[model samples]
Target: MPGPVFLRGDTVSMRTLERDDLDLLQKYRNHPEVRRLLGRVHPQNRDKVEQDFEGYMSNAVNLLACVEEDPVGFVALFDWNESSGHAELAYWVAPEHQGNGYASEAGELAVEYAFDERRCHRLDAGAHATNAASRALLEKLGFEEEGRRREHVFLDGEYVDTVLYGLLAHEWRD
Candidate 1:
């Protein structure tokens, strides 16, 4: 069974990722379509997935994005700096679940949790320059395009640019 829901939105809910869900997580991590945009170039095994899961549990507010108990995606606020009141956000929806507005709604919930519950001052995110959908999602969430890193990540056989985005707590409308 999946862990209890930690945050809930109108159509999506964010839940603590559990050990029981590691297999699904592994599937997502290895899926070529999902991994490409996620900047994951190498295939991941179950052992590696479990190891990463441990790290996520210790280091981040990593959650599974779900809709009515069906897991659809993943979202996280990681690399948190309590003293600096800042963190980074990352999220991805399964290909089958993409375009259903789950990513957007889950992202809103994560942003709210970061600023209100976690009391973060700013949140940062990045997307591959070629990923229009991810870029659009960040913009839709009130994040500003801060800058771009030229040829920052190697994906699908060549280097690609990364577009950085940031959102300040005071700047967040909700």
Candidate 2:
């Protein structure tokens, strides 16, 4: 059977991420600028990427974002706590494709999926303090900044604070 459409926007569509996508997805994941903000801790080769992909895909609702035929990025609703109706959100677009708003569109779709389709009570997200673009995207999607963990992530030899954001289902708009 075909998979369901997890989310779709004007220019982007999201679907279940399959094993076949690992190679190209890994290329995007390895982009220095992309990994820098994603808080990647270690260098990732194909094997490492495949391993991580399997682990994540098996547990979460991860969707590959595509612009027609070309994969641009991905968005995910994971770390679910069914009892509490909560889950974490994550999204990223290829660094070269950053300016096209793919991340924002896909992220909005994921938020809708979490709140409307999944019936999640709340969704959480985090962004590095220095990543203003990502922070702005969350803000635009109706996520409110809830807190900040001072120097929470050690990356590239230094630590960076992670800004927390959350949106409650009742607070969401169509």
When superposed on Cα atoms, how far off is each prediction in RMSD? 1.1, 2.3
Candidate 1 residues lying further than 4 Å off, grouped into runs, are none
Residue lDDT tens for model 1, 96-133? 99999999999999999999998999999999999999
- Write candidate 2's Cα lDDT for 76-110 as tens digits: 78899999999999888887788898888898888
Cα deviation in Å at residue 120, candidate 1?
0.3
Cα error of candidate 1 at position 96, Å: 0.4
Overall lDDT per candidate, in order of appearance: 0.93, 0.84
Pick the TM-score winner. 1
Colliding residue pairs in candidate 2: none
For candidate 1, the per-residue lDDT at 52 reads 90
